[model samples]
Target: MRLSATSLEQVPPGIARYSYHRAAQDIGIVHFGLGAFHRAHQAWYTDLCMDSGERGWAISGVSLRSPTVAEQLNPQDGLYTLTERSGGESTTRVIGAVREVLVATEERETIIARLGSPGVSVVSFTVTEKGYARRTGGSLDLAAAEASFYPLLTDGLRLRRERDLPGLTLLSCDNLPANGRELERLFGEWLTERAPDLAAWVAAECAFPSTMVDRIVPATTPSDIDALENLLGVRDEGAIFTERFSQWVIEDRFAGPRPRWERHGAQLVRDVAPYETAKLRMLNGAHSALAYCGLELGHEFVHQAIGDPMLRGLIERLMRQEAATSLAPAAGQDLEAYADALLARFADPALNHRLIQIAMDGSQKVPQRWLETLAYHQRYGEPCPALIEAIVAWLRHVRGDRRPVDDPMAAQLAALWATEGSSGIAAALFGPQGLFSHVWRADEASLARLTRRLG
Candidate 1:
């Protein structure tokens, strides 16, 4: 038997199961990129709200390019198991917040209808950094704009406007800096170019709240699925595994009502900048450092990397010193404690967080994770050799033989390395036409520092 509405009762007694009235549920949220991280993070938070008697906020997840997620989820009646593992103990829970998943290619009209519904006041996104289809300088690649999600979002909002419906809160739950603002800017440019008139209405009514979401959802393996079957007494095709720790900090700028996510461990605040910066720099920055450096040292997983004294030392110093020092923490924010917690989370052996997984999108990740910190040091004449070393490692990673460099700019980066001398690779990538979103590049002094360490 597969885990579904029918198999709900068969789940083991020790495992948690939602008792929400699915029949009365309304799919008000339309989340894009229904990936494992979304399932583990945002969808799980909404699931908790449902258990606590919240109504009308069930998610209608949209998998943009692939039907694979839809196939895995829809068959199981949008049912999936989430396992939170810590130390050696694990907890299993069935998530019921997602009502259905729509593959965009197949169900475009239906998705547009849902998006235009007044009841769907929230259209959230967890599309990875690459999903925006952006250029190196953070603007939408206008040529690719038609195929990107923003145009689809424009169609949805246009329908809503035509039907005299109010605008929805456009929440961006990605790891980009000021993600909400970037999302708005990117979409604004796209909308202005495509649907010039709808821009003003969207500007006045819609809300794009910045959010900081934290969770380590490792890619589920076949063994994980088998383990879940043994624990649940049934198979669950959409099973996801994650760490015990999860946090969401959203800017309180909703256009209307939203889940009382704050009641269930989420933090609603005036500004998410401080929290987001800390996470991006200390947590995400160190993550990239670990990814690139760990791969160089023959480490496979996060725990393995952290277990290596040399890797751990570099990351710890990177987080607490290089990354932490760059941030202007808000009142009551303890960056050191945050760094300590991150270190602990990274060291959790149960997560099985792959270095290559974190390393996948180097071109999109490094600007926010490593380059900004480097830029900050450049401004202050401070030394962040830790970050520079990470950048160098990433440069080497982009030219590796073990696996394909899994980045959007892989071809361009490979070409840069193939044509440019390695010693000049640092200068070439940070030069006037550098293929990065960051405005800052290495000066002569910084270039010398980076070049001396590389080929």
Candidate 2:
């Protein structure tokens, strides 16, 4: 039997089924990019709130890319299992906070209508870094810009404005430095070009709160689905597996009322900048290093990379030395402790976090993860050979031929590789015309360092 609302009663006792879920509750949130992280993190927190007697904040999840996720869960009545796994132990829970799923390509109008609804006071999203369509110098990529998150967001907010509905809180749960502010700026630029009036309204009424969300959700494999079936004695097509650890830190500012996610262990802080910078530079930066370097050395998974002595050493140096230069920790914040915890999480054997998965879209990731820190290092006269090495590894990964690079700029980069010499290619890549800041292009010493490493 397939797991569904009707089959909830028959679910095995070992599975942690939600008892407080109600289909009749009004949906108060519309989340975009409904992937595993959203399911395991945000939806899990909302489910806990429902269990604790908060009933008005159900989620309507919208998958932007394709209908694959909706196809998997909609038949199950928006029900799915989330298995939290650690070494030799796991716990399963049925998440019901997501009351509906909509495929944006197929249901764009419906999504806009939902976003315009007075009942939905929050429009949260977890679109990855690439979804922002950013250029290298931390500006909006308006040249190749097509239909993306900001465009859709503009249409929805315009609808809300037309309906005279109050502005909603726009929460960004992606892993970008100052994600909320970055999103607000990107959306503002786009809106100003398209509709100046709506842009002003958004500037005044909408609140784009920065957020830091931490969770290790590996891509669910076929074997994982089989394991879920064995554990639950029912088919759960939409099942997801993740590590036991999770954290969410959000800026307290919002345009309107939102779920008291703090009540369920999320931190509501005055400024998420410190937390956001730490995670992006230390955790995400090291993850990219692992991805590019590990792939070059034949390590496929995160644990394998961390377990390898050489890769592990580079990652440690990255967090403790190079990446730390730009970090300003609050009192009682232990950098070493945070690094230790990240190492432990990355080394979890039960989690099959793929290096290639992290490696995807390097063009989008490198700016925030590595280049921004590189800029800080240059400004402060900090040594960053480890970061340079990681950049070399990324360059080699893009240049060499084990698998096709999955970046949006892959074809353009490949064309450059085919045409240009090493110095020329490096110059183009770090040049003003390319995806990097002009300062990098002008810094001959930095260019020489990277060229030496690449050679």
Candidate 3:
């Protein structure tokens, strides 16, 4: 039988089990994006909190697009296996933090009502980079935005106001820079233009707190599921696999009551900028570099790419020399040590982190991951050789002839590549009207250099 509440007794003794009474805890958080990362990262942290006797913090997960996650978790009674692997060994645990899964399109009213509920104080999101639906400059792209998400959030807030409920904190756990501020600004733009009164109320009452979340969660495979089922003696459809390390740094700003997340290894700091920036430019930037450059060199997984001497050298240089240089010096942040730890993590053989998965949505990702570092170098008249190579690799990868470029701007990128050819594509891509034009439109010298490579 599948791993549902009734099958809890069948689970083995060695595997960590959820002992809490699931029916007693109220749903205090409604998280938007029920992806594997959320299940392995935030949900895991929440599970720890509940185990430590924290009440009223069970999560109600919302899937914005596919019904796949709801289908996986709902039948399992929101009970799933979390396998944390390290050094060729694994530890398994059943996470009972998630109480319900709702497909946004199917249960819009239910989500809104939950958001308005007095018990729910925080509404968090992990909807990936493109899911936020922002244009090049971080303004809300109203037309391109999903009615099920953005407008639905606005309607939810309006309902809260109507019901006289306390303002809820809106938490953004994405990789974007200043994620919390961006969320507030995007919603502010939408609300101000549509309903000015509601905008005013939100500005005064709600909290948009920035957060930095880090964990390496590779997509689980059927083989992995079979292995885990053998260990548990019960199949878990919503099982997730991740590394042993985890970090969550949240800016300590909330509109109302929130979970004591800090009690369970989370950092509640006054500012998350330093931590956020370093992770983006170092870890994420290196990942993108490895993705594009690794794929170009015909490597499949992160462990394989990191083992290659050339790719390893490029990423080390990209982290220590280029990305770390771009960040301002901060107290107690040993960026050199941080770089060392990242390299070690990258080389973990147990992680089957795919290059193509990281390579997806390059048009949406490169701005913070690589382009921002390039921008910083450009400002100081410094050279970023590794970054230049990675950018060239991305320019080549987006042509969409070999592997698929799973991006929202795929058609436009392919059209540019087809129409311009090698002689003109580099200039066209970095030119004023290009996909990355919003972040650092290249000067003539930069264009000429890229053209020479293509030549």
Candidate 4:
């Protein structure tokens, strides 16, 4: 028999339950991506609000791309387990903050209509770096084909034009720098082109709050399910296993009523710039460097890569040298302490953050984490030996052994590299155009250094 929400008593001990059949009052938030990270971080925060007995802070999960996740989750009655694994011990907590799941692709009109609902005070997204459709220069990428056709074309710009809802806050929990401003510019461009009237309306009303979200949620493995059943004594179809650490920092920008997330561990600040830069540049940038270099070195997972002293040294050097330069305002942040913490997180023997998974979508990632700093160093005449090495490693990853990296931008990088032979790889790296842009095109000496390192 199919499990129902009302069958909580049937659920084994240690597994929490939520009754989907219970009446749900329309709440204040709508989350765009129903990924594992969202389940572990944002949903957990909302659950804390619910536990506090605060009303109107519930969330309606929206999946914009596929129906598979909705199909899997809805049958479980929007119930999911947040499994935390550290060392040899594990804990499980079922999240109930998600009141419902909406498959936006299957119900596009319905999804759009929900945005217009009176109860939805805020619209949030964890759609990763690519979801915003941003350009390399840290602006909204309105030139995308979908920007002309899709309802939100470029991060809800078109939708705001059609509805003109002023009292709405658009929060982005992605890993981009100045994520909120980037969303604004994308929507701004669409408004200037499509509907000037609504564009003006959006300018007057609406909030795009920048955020920094951190957590390590690896793709669920079969062993994880086995462990969950053994520990929780229950079958959980929607369980997400992750590392013990998680953090969220948000700029205080909300319209209408919102949840008191600060009651939980979340930090609410006037400006999220310093926090955002610190996480983006140091943590995420090092992650990218390790992913490319580690994968090329035949490492399968993050922890496995960390096991290699050479790769570990490379990661340390990259963080200490190249990545450190990008975080100007956050310079006071304990670099060594942060690096030590990141190393421990990355080296968690339990979490299997696959190199191939990290290797995917390098095109979307490299621009922010690697190339941006390279450009910064070039413009200001800063030393960047480790950054240059990371770039060389990334180039090797793209070219080496056809290891089947899974990034969406892999094809684009391949095409760019195909213009020249292996020797031309350095030329492309130093090219005047493409994602690297003119600012990052290394001089002959730098190119020679990169070429020598790759060879």
Residue pairs clashing in model 4 are 360-407, 361-407
Tens digits of per-residue lDDT for model 4, 153-202: 23344454456554578888888788888777777776676567666667
lDDT for model 4, please.
0.73
Candidate 1 — which pairs collide?
136-437
TM-score of each: 0.98, 0.96, 0.98, 0.90
Candidate 3 ranges with C-alpha deviation above 4 Å: none
Q: Please, what is the whole-model Cα lDDT of each candidate in the order they appear?
A: 0.89, 0.85, 0.88, 0.73
lDDT, model 1 = 0.89
lDDT tens digits, residues 209-254, model 2?
9999999899999999987788787899999999999999999999
* lDDT of predicted model 3: 0.88
Write the number of the candidate with greater TM-score, choosing between 1 and 4: 1
Clashes of 2: 0
- Predicted candidate 1 versus true structure: per-residue lDDT over 31-70, tens digit per residue: 9999999999999999999899999999999988899899
The alpha-carbon RMSD values of the candidates against the true structure, listed in the order shown, are 1.2, 1.7, 1.2, 2.9
